[model samples]
Target: MASEEIQIKTDYITLGQFLKLTNVVESGGMVKLFLSEYPVFVNDSQDQRRGKKLYPGDSISIPEVGTYTVTRENA
Candidate 1:
């Protein structure tokens, strides 16, 4: 089945920080474990780096959590 995409504002967010903001995992260690064990697709490609810098226009897709397109919005 296809997953729905969720848009998230990332005006000044790094990949690690974004994961924390979205509550994907409890901490950086958890995110690292999840990224290694689980499939995290970025723009349809697998992304295993937990500290991969994410900026506006980047998109990430998680199996159970659906997709997230990065957008820059005013804080």
Candidate 2:
């Protein structure tokens, strides 16, 4: 699977926001429905919470989608 990097200026971001940022879903409202249909993995562990806090080093994997790595860049 291809790996993608998502840069964030803040300390953390929510899974729902991340999904939208990555274009995995069209909007935040679709996050919940999307999660229920697909398995989302945080560092290889399944996570279904749209509010889950994702740190800079956190890695997200969606089998139907692709792998994403959270990265923090100084602004």
Task: Write down the TM-score of every candidate.
Answer: 0.74, 0.95
Question: What is residue 25's positional error in candidate 1, in angstroms?
Answer: 0.3
Q: List the residue pairs that clash in candidate 2.
A: none
Pull out the clashing pairs in model 1: none
Candidate 1 stretches with Cα past 4 Å from truth are 1-12
Please state every model's RMSD to the true fold in angstroms. Answer: 2.9, 0.8
Q: Per-residue lDDT tens digits of candidate 1, residues 1-75?
A: 454333455444666676777788888778877777788877788878776777777778888876777776655
Return the TM-score for candidate 1, rounded to 2 decimals.
0.74
- Alpha-carbon lDDT, every model: 0.71, 0.95
Write candidate 2's Cα lDDT for 1-75 as tens digits. Answer: 878999999999999999999999998889999999999999999999999999999999999689999999878
